[model samples]
Each structure stands twice: as C-alpha cells, then as structure tokens.
Target: MDYGPWSLVVDAGLIGGLLLVGTLIRRWVGPAQRLMLPASVIAGFLGLLLGPRALGILPFADQLGTYASVLIAVVFACLGLGEDPHARTFGRSTAAFSAYSFAMYALQVGVGMVLAYALFVPVFGTPDGFGLLLFAGWAGGFGSAAAIGSVLGDAGWAGASSLAFTSATVGMLAGIVGGIAIANWGARRGHTDRLGRFEELPATLRTGLVPPGDREPTGIATTSASSIEPLGLQVCLVAVITVAGYGASEGIGLLFPSFSAPVFVLAFLAGLLVKGLARRTPAWQYCDQRTLKSISGVSTDVLIVCGIASITPSLVADYWVPLTLLFVTALALNLAMFRWIAPALMHGAWFEKSLFTWGWATGAVATSVALLRMVDPDLDSHTLEEFGLAYLPVAPLETASVAVTPLIVLTGLGWTIAVGWTAAGLVALVLPFVLGWTRTRRRPPDDRVEAAP
Candidate 1:
C-alpha cells in the first residue's frame, strides 16, 4: 500500500492540470461546449489509470474519500449562493412537479439496488446489503454520492465509501450521454435557442453603443446598484459563509446518527440567506458581482479538484458488478422516465419540463448547468434562476435520503428493503400522475403529495 512520488499528481489536486489540457484540446477544436461532463469523465478515468489496484502508480487513492467530504460542502455553498430561499417563487405547481420528478427518478435507484443486491451479495457474500442500497441512492444523486459516502464512513459505515465512488462515476457518465441526447433531440425538433438569442445588443444609456437618439430612459430608477467591495474582502466573506455552512452541517450530523449534511446545499442556502439579509446593509453592498463571480469560480474549481482526487480506480475494478448494475439501472430508468412519464405528467412549458427531467437524472449542479447551457447560452441567468428555485425545495429530500440510509440499515434489514422498494415503485408507477397534477392551472395541496420515494 506504499505510494510513490508519482502519487503527487493525485495529491496536489492536479485536476487543474487536467482542465488545462481539456481547455487546450477544446481550443484546438471548434466552439464545442459540454466541457464539465467531459472534464469529470477525464478526471475520473485518470484516477482509474493511476490507482492502486490498476497501474499501481498512485497508491494514495484511498485518500479520495476524505477529499470528497469537503468538496461536497463547497459544492453546496456554491448552490446556496446561486439560489434565493425567500423567493419561494416556483409558482403554484412547484411542489407537485418536484414530487413527481423524484418519484420518477427513484426507480433508477431502487431497481438498481434490488438487482445489484441479488447479483452481488450472493456472489461476494457481504453482509452489508443496506450499504449497497445506499450506494444505489448515491449513484442516482451522482456528484453528491462521494461526499455522502465519506459521511457514511465517518459514521462507521465503511462499505459506503466504495459504493459512493462507483456510483458517482456511473452517474457522471449517464449525465453526459443523457445531456447530449436531449440536446440533439431538442435541436432537431426546433426547440433549442439560436446564438442570436444570446447576442447582447448594446443599450444606449447602459453601454453607450446604441445611438443616443434611439430612445429615452424612463424616469424609473434601476432596481439594483453596484457594490464595490475589495476582492480580498469578498474572498474572506465567501470563505466565512462556506465555513459556517460546513460547521453547521457537521454539527447537525452529530445530533442524528444517519443524518449526513450535504455541505453544498447548506453553503448554498447560507450564501443566499446572507446576501438577502445584507440587502439594506452597506457592508454587503461592497460584495459586488465580480467578487461573487470570483468566489464561485474558485469554490467550484476547488470542488472539482477535490472530487477528482477522491475517486479511486480500485472501485472500478473491485466493485464492477454493483457499479455496472447501478449504471445500467439508472440509464434504463432515465430512458423510461423521459419517454413515458415526463411527457405524460407535464405536457407544456417545455423549458421547465425539460429542466425537471435533466436535473433529476443528472443530480449534479454542474451537469444541470451544462444541460441548460446547451439549450441556450444567453439563458444563463434565467436558467440558473429557475434551477435555483426548483433545486432548493428538493435539496432537503436529497440530503435526507442519503443521510438516513445508514440509520435505516442500523434499525433492520427490512426497513432498508422497504425504503428501496418504495423509492423504486414511486418512480415506475406514481410519478406521472404527480407531473400531470402540477401541469394544470389548479394547484395540488401539499397534503395530496405522493408518498416518499
């Protein structure tokens, strides 16, 4: 298990190097997008190449679990900054639509668990059936799986670490394929936005590029003002927010045995909350757009680097059965969902409808951004807004399921099976109706929400 200097690549968070290579490659090619998914794949595969069980060049692969834990927290902080909890502006049907979306997506996790348990437990003969079930959940959740897996290990569930890495890799691959498919299909159907949609015309008053006599400014004041905080201060503010979120989440995990806080979600909420509170305060006004952007990119880049370091190649070889089973199951479930359930549930509002499917299927913020960006680059602000709204309410559910899985196993094997079956059944049978309910003008009451997946 001794690691050599070659392990430095994995140790020094070399994902930046990988990204540089990717950027160079993309530059050589045309103006192709979908960089995140490809970057994720490359990083994951690179881990496999240098991993202990494979080429044995990077025996330090075991450290990836630790990196994933912190990376997840950072990811959550980014999410919080991008979202606004106070808005609660998802319109009348958001709850129902979200409920239905989870239901439909649960089959991917449930069926995969059942099938994997049947195939692997009998062959490998491990007693951690519940751990395997939790693994399936992580796979369905994708990017969060590694973080949740580490949280599981910290809670004394060792099997979860392996399960998390395997599942996360599979989920990333699935998202890439699904995103490309959806983009191609949508484009063929004349649904994708043209480049012109993103082309920004200069405003006479705002940019001075438009003719001066073209139009007169309305006497109304602009809704927002520019904040001029120093870049260093802004960096410190972001750091404080992320640390607060991580500490708060880790503290909460101590209170509940199976409750692992998804740090990314907490950080995201904390950022948004802090920003909202600072609205009237001049101090917060100092935190300007440039500051926020710099903080976000730094955090996101760190997360990606940590994520790449945490993935072990050994899992790819050692847990091939469970990993492959989960991958195939998620793909099959997503296909069924997009083809049958989504169309049935939400007939119109193509943008929201597509977003719902893509977000659930991918379960990664980066993946979701890629999906929306593929549709329209000019739509970054609007898409991020909608996604922020749709994702936050669902954040609790995602975190709860991951955090609670270990506890469910501690109770009894029957409980784990029950949860798995319930989740799978909801996706296969109950999701469509919820979608249909939300698609209508009438809002369905929360009391009518479907059973937990």
Candidate 2:
C-alpha cells in the first residue's frame, strides 16, 4: 500500500498501543517475567501477528525497516558523543579480554563465511552474502543487522533486510534463553552464589517496576527550563551531530559514488569530534551522560520493535534450512569459546569474564551485563571495567568489520577474507598464552562509557 508522511504517525500510534499491551501482559504473565523479555520484543511479535504479513489487522507503513535503519544512526550518535577521549590504561587482564573479544569478531565473521562457501553454497546454493548475516545479528544485535542489511540490500541482494532481522531476533532469543540456561548451569556448577531460580528473582526485576526506595532519576537537568529544556538541548546536540554525519556521508558518496558508507559510522565520527570540541568549553560541563543515554534508550526501543516487525516471514521460510544449519554451527562454536577457551586464558575471575564475553559474543553487551548481574551481582568481577578499557580497540574492529565485510565479500574474495579472519582469530586466541598477558587489574566499571545498542 502507498503511504505518505502521515504513515509515520500511524505506525508510531500502533507501536505505542502494542507497547502498552505488551507491558500489561508482562506484568500479569508469569512466563514472560521469568524470561526477562523486553517489552519491545513482545510488542514486535504482536506487530508481526497483526501486521500485513500475517493477520493484516493493523495497518503499518511500508518503511518499517527504513525507520529501524535510520534510528540506528541516532543510537550511534549518542554513543559517539559519550566517548572519553582521554588515554586509557590497559593491563594483561584487559589485554586478555581484548584478545578474546578480537577472536570473537574474527571467528564469527571468518567461520560464518567459511561455512557459507564450503557448506551452504555447495549444498543449498545460498549467495556469497549469506556469511554476513551471522555477525550482523549475533554480535551487533538489531543495529548491526540494520547497518549490514542496508549495505547488502543496496548491493542487489534481495531480502537481505528480512534475513538479517530474522537472524538478529533468533540470535537475541538464543542470547536470552540460552544465557539463562548457561547462567543456571554456572550457578549449579558453583560458578556463582547469587542465582537460586529465575522464579526467585526480585519482583521489581521481574515486573520491571522500581520501588520507591530504589527509584533513581533517569537524568539530571543539563540546561535550565527557562533557557531551553534539558532534553531539548540534548536532542539538539544529537541532531546537529546527525546532520553533520549525513553531510559527510553525502559528500563522500558524491565524491566516490561507488563507495557508500553507512551514516551511523560517520555520525559516530561526528559525535567524537563534537565531544572533543566541546571538552574545553563551559557547556561541556553541563553535558550529562545519563541525559544522552535516555535519548538513546528511547530510539533503541523503537528500533527494536520496528526491526522485528519489519521482517518478512516468507523470506525467512525460503532461507530456513541454511539459516538453521548456520545458527546451530555458530552456537556450538560459541559454546566452546564460553566453556573452554575463555577459562584457560583469563586469569582472576575467569568464570565471570568468560561469562561476560560469552554473553557479548552471542548477543551484545546488555546481555553480558544481565549475565554478570546474576554471576557477580556485586559488580566486583570488574569484567565490565576491563571490557571498557579493551573497548578502545575492540570497538573499532567491530565497526570496521561491519563497514568492510560487504566490500570484501562482494569483490568475490569471500573465501580469502574468511581464511584471513580465521587466521587472525586463531592468532589472537594464541597471543595471550605466548605473551603472558592473562593477569589484569580488577577495576570498577567506568561510567564514562555507554553500552547502548
């Protein structure tokens, strides 16, 4: 169906209604609370049920995927703005974690591509681009899916967005459900003392409600109401950064039409520049981290719902066989990384750090945080802190993968890149042992970083 500008409002209203219903169901339903499912996920499934692909009860815009694609840039802009430009101190533990993380990205990309060429393409006739769907969803979540999907789709890969979104939803499900199982396993095997049962979780956590004593403000006012709303100020700052990124992306496209970079990355670079420029200004003092996070939170939630709902079931049905094989293989390898590789190399708090990387490797950092809370509820493991230091280089590697994966794969050198990444992953895995950089300082999680998706 043809849609105009007003379609956005209609879509937003429908999403809002679904969100309300999703929240209510979570509050009343026992299983949902136990699963710790996000309201966005619930709402997205509802949308899928009611949307055109299924029941067609509620009308939605044709550009649901586009909404998700654009919102990701907004999310990244907040991330870029939150960067701490100061030099960081890294220790062996941090180095070990970094190496582990590097391996995660490399192997996921490498093995995925290797499987695509060696197994799927020969047997199922899947395209060369099939390899990218794994990391796009598993490692980066919906944001990475949107970023990578757009690139592949533009490169003439039909239905890439739907496949990417499906991969992400499935990956997230694995992360949450599988994570809970793994956490429980850890608890049973004497890895942690905090977890008794998911049922025994505090009501506030299960119900997503904050009691009066535990209530904390989302953010403090960064600007006076008289001058401008604090949130408005933040929105304005992010908007400027976004516009700057758009300009950069557009200029780059004009100069080199063959190369199209995602606006999110450019916006992220713009955010870093903005953050650095503002560092010395008096206005910088008023830039609260929490405020930016609140903005990011809103956009991230909306995109998750839109991304899932936008998936085309038919596209998924067509690719189910290969996707199933691919995901199963990836999960088995992930288990090895979690249960074996991480423990052997990591020093103090090996279980905690490995668990953190396991969660992140399968999904994103939020998943890592949830698992960590169950294992090291007291935040003593310093896994997050160490990851933060390691993030300095880790973040770039991930970003580069998303941007360059398609370029390399499209050039018909998919297998070569696969071998190279595999070798890189293997080398990273071995370096920790050879260099003896397994020990690390157990520091506190840094507030300067925002693990926003």
Best by TM-score: 2
lDDT at residue 326 of model 1 (Cα atoms): 53
Instruction: Write down the lDDT of every candidate, Cα atoms only.
Output: 0.53, 0.80
Roughly what TM-score does model 2 have, to 2 decimal places? 0.90
**Model 2, 261: alpha-carbon shift in Å?**
2.9
Any runs in candidate 2 off by more than 4 Å, and if so which? 85-88, 199-204, 438-453
Q: What does candidate 1's lDDT look like per residue over 81-130, in tens digits?
A: 55335657554345445554556444444554466356555666543443
| Pairs of residues at least 3 apart in sequence or in different chains that clash in candidate 2 | 93-439, 93-440
True-vs-predicted CA distance for residue 312, candidate 2, Å: 0.5
The TM-score values for the models, in the order shown, are: 0.64, 0.90
Cα lDDT over the full model 2 = 0.80
Q: After superposing candidate 1, which stretches have Cα over 4 Å from the reference?
A: 1-10, 29-41, 47-65, 77-83, 86-97, 105-142, 156-159, 182-229, 237-297, 349-352, 365-392, 410-453
Q: Lowest summed lDDT over 10 consecutive residues: which window, candidate 1?
A: 444-453
